[model samples]
Target: MSTYGSRGDVEPMAALAVTLQELGVEAVVCAPPEDEFRALLERAGVEMVAAGMAVKELIAEAKANPHITLPERARKVTSRQYEAVLEVAQKADVIIGSGLMPAAAGARTVADQLGLPFHLVAFQPVTMPSPYQPPVAYPGRPLPPDVTDNRELWKHDAESMNVIFGAAVNDHRVSVGLPPVPSIRAYVLNKRPWLAVDPVLSPWRPSDLLDVLQTGAWILPDTRPLPAELEAFLEADQEPVYVGFGSMAMGNAPAEVARAAVEAARKQGRRLVMAKGWAGLEAIDEADDCFVVGDVNQQKLFPRVAAVVHHGGAGTTTAAARAGTPQVIVPQVVDQPHFARRVAELGIGVAHEGSVPTSESLAEALNRALGMTRRAQEMAGQIKTDGTLVAARELGVA
Candidate 1:
């Protein structure tokens, strides 16, 4: 019930929590403090527990000094929540860990303590059908298994396969005050110890886990319809390209990013719609062809766009995919590159090199995405059909 991270990390859980509430299931979402985030959840009619750290501080530090920032502190808080859960795990029938951070890991500890079943959840496939040394407990469905063994699963090369993540289970045991066990392989979910979580929301094989969970996109209360300015922006223009860096992108020089996007759009003769994210782009004056608006729902927004340019967060990737819009990702760091690779591999989009992407490079990628052939369009359609509700159903919470 407790989770912590940036708004992107916490928002999805908030969405899921709200969806659970609509089904008469009450769930509390926890995260580092951010008033905007609390507002989002509050509008969804979901209860949020703030961890008292300013999310803006975390964003600033992540860009300035990623090695020491909120994620580490968030981990500490999440790990600490286990003491609270330990007291209640016995009364709870099921515990689910949505991410691999302290909260999810802590959930696993308390689950085992109370002998409750737990499932690991993943929003991406990188952690699944794992590539590193295979977890003996759960030998995953090897990627292109015909081409390699379980060891060769993660590393596209054999030499890399020889290297392993080492005995992380022991580390987890130590972190949670549990006895060191054997070099236990992956957890029950992915079968790779390093990729373990409480309950994985695996959609490829609905019955792969105990229950299939659905993706609960954030549900903002029905407010006044898009303001006239935004409505005119969406209606007057041809589907513009969407340029947004969700919760993670706030740390970036967003105005610069938005300006770069403007230059790219001008080159392509397309409009640019920027998501009102943590990235500080709100001050950019809106022109007839360009708009800076707050919180246009991604599920509703991406489809109207010709292409999406983003930082390659998994949730954003999914949103663009659902819209059947090809994506052009400019990955800054972290799991972004991984998601970027998946986009290229799946023909869903292209990944740019970094934060300093040139307008020409971005424009070219946008053209490539906008020019998706009929077959590619069909493929995108297939992906879109993996609806949020389907994700919920798979999780057994629908």
Candidate 2:
């Protein structure tokens, strides 16, 4: 299988690949050549195919212009990824995409050519193409027709959808002699579709979707040790608000954002644990209430926090949800806004309005998240109960 995105995008697929293997299926993940990610998957004994471009470069380009990044770099890299995975999937009975991957798309193309069955896996509600009506955030923009409640966003029609596929991706596939497939109605997992993901699932709405099959986030068994700084922070405070912006902080003025986040932490009287990867916190003086750490087990850390504040990456969003902790989504770009809207619409948290945010906005959103009502907690719990075991059954592995 292939996953095409930044670290947030690749890690979930790695975890899912592990899960799939646990069910006695051998799997491999197509990832960028990042040593950190590459090493982890290597340690897991999963085959890793290195894509041509670095994820860092792709992220930089995307941050510069999110409007076309998905179609350009994401789609192009993914198309080339297929050549690497074909050696394995051709001999296998089934193929799956962690989300959208060039390999997955390529694999899908090969599947149609060879008449094989392929499944597309989603980690976010917006990606699932489910049938549940998403709450209206922007009035008159009342959600697209492609989103639904379904857990799996399988491609029903490959023809028309293929045309809407990015030109870069299309050219790559055609160069490889792959026939164009028509676009199928993609199930929108979350109603918001503006985020960074496959665009073939556009023009969708709640009515145009199906009910969610899998309801909860996939839970991975944690066994890694925490870095000393992270451990120290955990020991210093029983629970703190987790804060970090994944790859989103690379190009932005991270220090300013970090300072604002730190200030907000102080006002709320909550301990702060920023992901060590947080870009701009080096200039800030560390207080007893603040700590910076590397390699947090998000599944483990998020639940223990009083709240979470971060760029609204899909994986982080789900991690916060799984922890049953309210979140303050300070989206930087792309799908961040889309996910932030979902966080607010679900009443799971508040969104910091506008592309740029201030400490006050961050604090307010944090306050609202920490003040989640019983209804919001219950809804979060419902999603927590999602069973991928049933998904295993559907794959005929359970």
* Best candidate according to TM-score: 2
Q: Residue-wise lDDT of candidate 1 within 81-187, one digit each (tens)? A: 56555654555666655543445555666677677776555554443443333322212222464654644443332222221211333355577667754322233
What is the Å distance of residue 225 in model 2 from its true position?
3.6
- Model 1 worst lDDT window (10 residues): 192-201
**Whole-model lDDT values for every prediction:** 0.58, 0.61
lDDT (10s digit) by residue, model 2, range 172-205: 6577777543342331122222222212112234
RMSD of each: 6.8, 6.6
Candidate 1 regions off by >4 Å?
22-24, 51-55, 59-75, 83-91, 132-177, 180-224, 250-253, 282-288, 373-377, 384-398
Compute the lDDT for candidate 2: 0.61
